[model samples]
Target chain A: MKTLLDLLMLSCKKASELIDKQLLLNLSLKERLMLKIHTRLCEACFEYEKQSKLLDKLLLKHISTSEESQIPIQINIELKQKIIHNINPKK
Target chain B: MLNEMDTNNPATTITSWVKLYSDNLFSWALHKTSDREIAEDLVQDTFLVAVNSFDKFEGKSNPKSWLFAILNNKINDHYRSNFRHQTTNNTISLDEYFDANEHWRPEETPQPWLVESSHILDNPEFTKQFEECMQRLPQHWFSAIHLKYIEERKGVAICQEIGITPTNFWQILHRAKLQLRKCLETHWFKI
Candidate 1:
């Protein structure tokens, strides 16, 4: 007794959630169809999916780039001394 | 270095390992978590556990890998405990984004963000802004996003390790991304 509207209609809120879900897992056939329908009818959700994907892409790139550059971190000499002291005790 | 070192002396052996590995572990922990204090604490805890299990860990795995595995477990526990300890204060209402009918509110609706610069993330200032926005996220949400994007971990793997349901994971990501999107728009794009 499921109608096409019932199967395919999703509010932007739900559609956005499905968009995020699709990133981590494949949406069900109904979920996919509903997402497709909703994004078609909703420009905001369409922009949202695009922006969300872009954000992930940028964040990933930033992470790798920052790591490669090493963020100019100074080795924590104090923490090192502390660890050595803690582990060597009563040995 | 290890061949000449005294394996019988736990103190000397662990001290050498600490001197070698602590810096690498700290940088990694810092990357995974942007907090310096937490990163240092995790490294401290990782070594403490390593000392307790040093005999058990003997001759089984490479020291580097063994230490990393322990650190990873600590990181997972960090995420799990943060998620478990979360109260209503940690959650932001979904009503801010959607209307009573569950459609996007006019003000909260997503807008196109022009990402024309392929080298966008290369900009030092933008990267700073990005990190700041990520810092605004709840601890659990930040961990989820970090696992998914920075570590490129699988959803199922993250859910299994972090002990959160897939449905809840997606919902958190949805909300997290919305905040990120809005933050970047206001700070980077609009600027």
Candidate 2:
């Protein structure tokens, strides 16, 4: 039998899409309500929301420190010499 | 080539710029690409392009930013070319995680991670695993997330840079996060 919860329910796929979209954009009233109902009834979506948030925090910190402010790598002297030679053959 | 090493042209000389900027550029390229040979080639290519267009530099923008702009283009080109050649099997399907009724499969349900696992973000081992997992993602997905969260760019800026529409950006972010979460669970949380 069709019920209100069943009518409002979103599939895991749709619920997850809304979850991702929520990070970038605001959900409408219906989307928010449907997703909320889906998550409450669906354990997987609940855990996905938690893990997604955790990933954002951890990845932001991890990539900022590691990729943005990296420990300086030693440049290959030979490579530098080769580049200079190629750029200005006379020099 | 004519000698351009006069004091008046100090900043523009190939030798002077190499001594000053090569180390910084090389290190940056090496870090972003994670391959020594490719990084070296990119740096070389950047300099060659810069030398070709030295006349257009105009001394308006800072040399570092101009050089970085060139390097960024080179990186984008490499990724675009690589993406075209890569196989399509890496794409994730929503159907794999959900049933026809739109519910998650039992195997697809996520287990609760340790509450304190967020602290592992600072750990070196976890960072390595995170980086590996990120690298495993399709190039475009990695680029989108990298520009959005890692670079902290605005949504519009990310879409502009990636040449994706706003809606497409959100979809990519959603799928990328899903893949990242699953990868992290296997490699880091394990709970």
Candidate 3:
């Protein structure tokens, strides 16, 4: 039988993983039980779960949408030429 | 012009890969090193290595993965070669820095102070703070986090690329997150 502390740590890890997943999802049975037991006894992990969810929202907001631009035309041409020449030495 | 290439030529395939992946690879390297010059050199080195070993690439994996594997080895080599000279300048005393008793506990009824995502682009300080927090992480942990999170690679794929077990990968990520949160709390959120 896992100790309460062990169960709490597992719950914390699962809670963090869930933050990146779909919102308002139900926890796994084990996770739900761990949460019920731990949150009833330990206020810190409860607050942590809340804060982790909030942080996930903030992270999604800050994710960069900028698509990577192309390599400069000159370098692309030069590299292409080099590779072509390497493939066919007499090119 | 690359348009003149015969469709079956290996050169064409190589050039296509370069065209497709160079910018992404360069950006990845730049973010990792935080030095544009070094990043460019690393990118060039990656291509050179790929080209020289082109025959070894049996198309078993995607071109991007192959190139990244080469680049990872190059980066590791660069670090190993420079570690001695780099470590001489600023030595941290571990005993003075780490305290087992200084454990962190989350606040009770934590006030939500989430920054809006729209502000990240405009706020240079936030980006700087993020980069600083990233830099404080151990190199392996930092690499694991960047490859997994920023690159958006799945755990199994990242494990394949980095040659680490899934358990080790999770451990690295856990440590990295814990350190980043601690750094952020101390550097940005302390009131």
Candidate 4:
């Protein structure tokens, strides 16, 4: 059983890599199969994947909030002044 | 969103646009470069280009989108000149997390975050620490995170734009995420 499992299984490290790739892109059929086998067989890799997904969620919220006004980004008056200065028609 | 673009006196309303759009532009630029001064400069340059080509604007398109388009171009150019030339080191440090048999080391395994509320973003301290963790990542990694997460761009396109191959991009994100998870666990989760 160990030998058969080894034949199809990905190590947790490789499985984790595949998990992250799955978050961003579609894995090839073989990779998808292997990741499925490994995660089903190895419980730790499955938990890692869950945590990774959670991290992605948190990161999106973190950045989107920053994108919005959650982070105090002061609009500098000088930035407006400098831009107006540049566009001014120099006689 | 209406630009109020009068071809008659194209330059007149730029001052208003400058005030209206600088914050959004600077915010985006800051996200891209993670530098306040550079974000400021990019905002300044974006307004200059917008003013120069004001007649072309036509006021038909959403002014915010139009200005954002210009700012995005400036950001692309910024990355092209600054980062595209630098070689991306594809060496991913996996041994730190894996043992000889490629199993996760006991200490390096992923533990539960124990997050109770989905509204964790409401916690300013957690979000602040989250930004600190992100700031800890290298510039290229930050750019990768931004493009992948915030922009939701494809992996191949992100790799192409960042001058890294697809596999290299994969490895960078993997390692960068590993660091982030560890940092967050240490700092926020305490698990």
Best by DockQ: 2
- lDDT (Cα atoms) of all candidates against the true structure: 0.79, 0.74, 0.54, 0.76
Write candidate 3's Cα lDDT for B1-191 as tens digits. 33543444566577677777776676766655655666777877788777667778767677888887787677655544443233232332222222343212233122334545445434667767867886777665555554554433356765665555565556445545556665665666564
lDDT by residue (A1-91, candidate 4, tens digit) is: 4796678889898899998887557899989899889888787888788878888888776654344444466667787777777777572
**lDDT (Cα, tens digit) per residue for candidate 2, span B50-110:** 8877777766677777887898788666654453344244455677667887777776677
Clashes found in each candidate (C-alpha, N, C closer than 3 A)? 0, 0, 0, 0
DockQ scores of the candidates: 0.53, 0.57, 0.13, 0.51
Q: How many backbone clashes does candidate 2 have?
A: 0
- Evaluated at residue A15, the lDDT of candidate 3 is 45
Q: Name model 4 segments beyond 4 Å from true.
A: A28-30, A41-43, A61-73, A89-91, B1-11, B31-33, B62-65, B76-83, B160-163
Candidates by DockQ, descending order: 2, 1, 4, 3
- In Å, what is the interface RMSD of model 4? 2.9
> Least accurate stretch of 10 residues (summed lDDT) in model 2 chain B?
B1-10
DockQ of candidate 4 is: 0.51
Residue pairs in steric clash, candidate 3?
Answer: none
For model 2, the DockQ equals 0.57
**Candidate 4 TM-score over all chains jointly:** 0.81
lDDT of 4 by residue, B120-184 (tens): 87788887787889889877677666666655556687667666667777777788899999888
For residues A5-73, write the lDDT of model 3, one tens digit per residue.
774554434444333222323457776665566555545446555655444333333332233342222
Off by over 4 Å in 3: A1-28, A36-43, A50-66, A69-91, B1-28, B35-38, B46-114, B117-122, B150-153, B160-163
Better of 1 and 4 by DockQ: 1
